[model samples]
Target: MIDYRRIGALLAGRREGYCLPQGLYNDVDVFDFDMDAIYGTGWLMAGFTCELPTPGSYVSQMFGKWPVLIVRDKQGVIRAFHNSCRHRGSMICKPGSGSAPRIMCPYHSWTYEHDGKLLAAPRMGDDFDKSAHGLRPLRIEFAAGAMFISFAENPPPFADFAEKLEIYLGPQRMDRAKLAFESTISEYANWKLVMENGRECYHCATGHPELARTFPVTMSKHFDRANDARAKEFVDTMTANHLETEAIEGDWWQLARFGLNRGAETLSMDGHHMVRKLMCEENQGYVGSMRLAIDPHCFLHATSDHVFMFSAVPVSPTETLVTGKWYVHADAVEGEDYTVEGLSELWTRTNLQDKELAENNQLGVNSPGYLPGPYSRDAEMLALRFTDWYCNTARAYLAGRTAMDAPIHVD
Candidate 1:
């Protein structure tokens, strides 16, 4: 049996502003704890809303160990539910995505509407309560057209985070974007290791030559807002962009844009736009890439031409599945507007490189000789912040506190 008390003690003992102890990444008990403390209660990226454009379209995946189905109802609303059939507990939707009139269980033919209402369960007695047998619903929230699902009975308020996220994503028009391509890769590393490696680009200089062509090595380090002039300038520019966006869109959110170091306008081979058309009128000229890191699972990068999204899902103590999606303008044509090769080149290469790095790091950390190391204050600040957030959130959950009550660790 797993010792919850022991895991709680370990979480409390974690060192602040540094990498976690090796056991946290390699122990089976600790991995189970992580599935509960991190993936269980937090809001997680499901997929882009655009993926389910037509009514009855659906996507299914495992959210932690829970089988989840995301579907667009006939009313054009996206809803998520436990993928199990209410009658016999068989999976209602298969893995991957497709369009369907209704979800019918392959085992017993129990049928449900796209919104999860129980429609029929043949041969049941008249006394049976069909209304009581709907698929279990999970809480869902949206930000910049990305669907976020929460398994917690009482999930945190998404308004504050969504409000801020809109500012960074509004000009990109993610809601109107269409899926260009998607790829999934499995990494032989703990989920946290995958997240930590992605939180910073310190390894990009040596690990990802193709990605570094447009990404600046110097800009990878954490900036000091109090002392760094460039940091202040970036903030000022974002503020100006927010104001300009609010003036045009009739709504404003806090902190909009930031400057990218390289003259490269977007994530591509030659440091230029990958698509012929651009989003938002203000972005007639290259406005630089806008990035957002939603802790625990999702990372987003948006340019005038397209948006790239990444989600990290834990499969086991030693394995994680990383999914990447590229979104372009819904009207974009493959032959004339943008090529998939051009849109996916940078992140596809970077993702493969980071997979190797994380796997190598996990192998070392899994060894008995490995020990916790100090985090670099400059280059690895984001990684440190990520660890801090994880520890704090885990501690709070163990103490029976509200998940959102933990300190906000932002970049």
Candidate 2:
């Protein structure tokens, strides 16, 4: 068994406003703990609702080590289940995604309904109980146009999260959108490092020329003091844009909208919209990018014309699989409404830049001379918030407390 006390001590020793200890990032024990305490228990954004537009449509992939199958049942409800068969312990579905009237096990040919009920077993004992052997169901939550799942017996209060999410994503009508493009990249780095790289843009000026054209370099430092006239001007512009967006949407801008720099409107190479058709309902001018965070594993960016959802899946102690999905209007036609290459080009290059950054970060942290470094007082607030949540959540788990029941803290 893993040593809970030792792990608790490791978590307790984490210093605030600084990077994580080298051991926490490189040790096998800590990685396993993270998988259970964070990813397994938290409400992680798995996929969008549009992926399963019709009944019997399904998508299967490994979310951590658990092979999960997300399917739309005959009731028009999306449900998740472990992809393994109950009788012989074999994968019921293949590795990729497709549509099927029923789930069938290749090994024993056991057929199951889309709702995960065992429909037929070729030859079992005369007294076999099919009702008792249905596929194990998992906890799933839906909000806006996204679907989230949890592996823990008791997950955090998702209804509360969804209530807030609607205020941010409701106008966009994400459930009405469809997937236009998707890409996956395997990075040779720790999962924490990948998350850390995502939460800050301190390297954007030098590392990401294409993204820098649209994204402000000082975005992560929300409350920091402005150092120059240009910096002050950026802050003023962002504030004005945010207030305007809130006025139009009729809701308080909690953490939804963020202003970009260089006079760019969207995340294109030229800082403009890639498609003419808009995704959100409001036809007002481009206010800013709608940014939302679900904590620990998911971040979303919605623009006037499109939306991009990014997620990281831990593969091992030293590797992570990062996935990005691009969304547009359901009726948007290719070539006429939007080009896949145009919608995907900006983020594809940005993701590659981030992959290299994470790989090098892992290499440095793995060295014997490595030590935790202080975070910048100006920037890196989100990174600090992430580390704080991670340590506190791990502590709660060690004390046998569910995430929902733990003490709440946010900046």
Candidate 3:
């Protein structure tokens, strides 16, 4: 149904390093046909590790359109299981999160351990082996403080993926930060738009005045993997360990960028007490700690003191549900200062800015008169890369190819 060779050419490009025409962003058909590029194949960070801090914790989450459950077993190892009942395919867990030694299917009361081992099922003939009907398990891996699950059989290991993209992520992913709060929203634009918008900071010069006041726009350019040779070498180092961010600089935005002096903090062994105060003065209120990423479909904003990740899950070609999770030190959260209001305000503002623009832009693209607008190279790169990846991956899926099975190319 699609031309794989032509799609590869669009992604490979002739002169733009790597680029695609604007039609990908405008076509409704593209979204409908290629939904799996996002919902399938590549890794997705689902259900934060902190949410399942102890053995026997389980949560119901969705992998794109399919529902999934992640559980921590008695052995303290986490596992992913399809949440549907083995009998009528009814959903087993109704709650979003909780602790249970064995998951009881609501429809027929079949039971499975948190590790996804099928322990017992109701009403089956004696000859039916419960072991053969265990809840199906997915490939699972961890990076820093977060966890990722993939449905594809034998998906690439998290360590292998990270090792290929090394230095980009410091040493470990910032997963240890305890979750303090979560914010969820239903966005009206495509999920890819949200991911693309967050990837580059070029928009900070205008659309994000608050962020611009904190970090230089140049940092976004520095982050680009195309022009920087160090970036390529760094990605290689990362793939060696499975790409994960090792440190939380201990500061959020403006304060971290300026207060530490880039050179001193660049190679420093510690980020302890990363920030005494957030970027804004008391009048603006301390913005609070955060971690940032636009990987796959996630826009993660994190800090050692707090962590929040926003993902736009596409409900259809035009609608997406945006969800956020907040994390903090276990003590800070269970104790006195775990309010999500301060950090939430900052995220909402930035999120609304993009939501407003993207939804309106979508409407315009729906009209027949829309034309390709000139894009600034920097802020636009994030969106551009998403477009490239979306088209390329879709074609790859059509051809039965995948990011994991592709030739390793970090070097």
lDDT of 3 by residue, 252-287 (tens): 111011111122211112322222332222112222
Q: Could you tell which candidate, 1 or 3, scores higher by TM-score?
A: 1
Per-residue C-alpha lDDT of model 2 across residues 1-411, encoded as one tens digit per residue: 555555766776677888888877877887788888888777778878898989899988778777888999888989999889988879888766788999999998999999889989889977899988899998988887788888888887666667767766776777778899988899899888998888788788898998888887765464333455654564466455432222111111124465566567677889877877788535353556777766677777888788988888888888899899899888888999889999999889999999999999999999989888987765776677777777777777777733534432221
Q: Positional deviation of 207 in candidate 2, in angstroms?
A: 1.5
Root mean square deviation (Cα) for candidate 3: 8.3
For each candidate in the order shown, give its overall lDDT on alpha carbons. Answer: 0.77, 0.77, 0.55
Error of 2 at 340 (Å): 1.6
Order of quality (lDDT): 2, 1, 3
Q: What would the TM-scores of all predictions be?
A: 0.90, 0.89, 0.73
After superposing candidate 1, which stretches have Cα over 4 Å from the reference?
220-256, 401-411
Candidate 3 accuracy as TM-score: 0.73
Q: What is the model-wide C-alpha lDDT for candidate 3?
A: 0.55
What global local distance difference test value does model 2 have?
Answer: 0.77
Question: TM-score rank, highest first?
Answer: 1, 2, 3
Model 1 — which ten-residue stretch has the worst lDDT? Answer: 245-254
Instruction: Provide backbone clash counts, one per model.
Output: 0, 0, 36
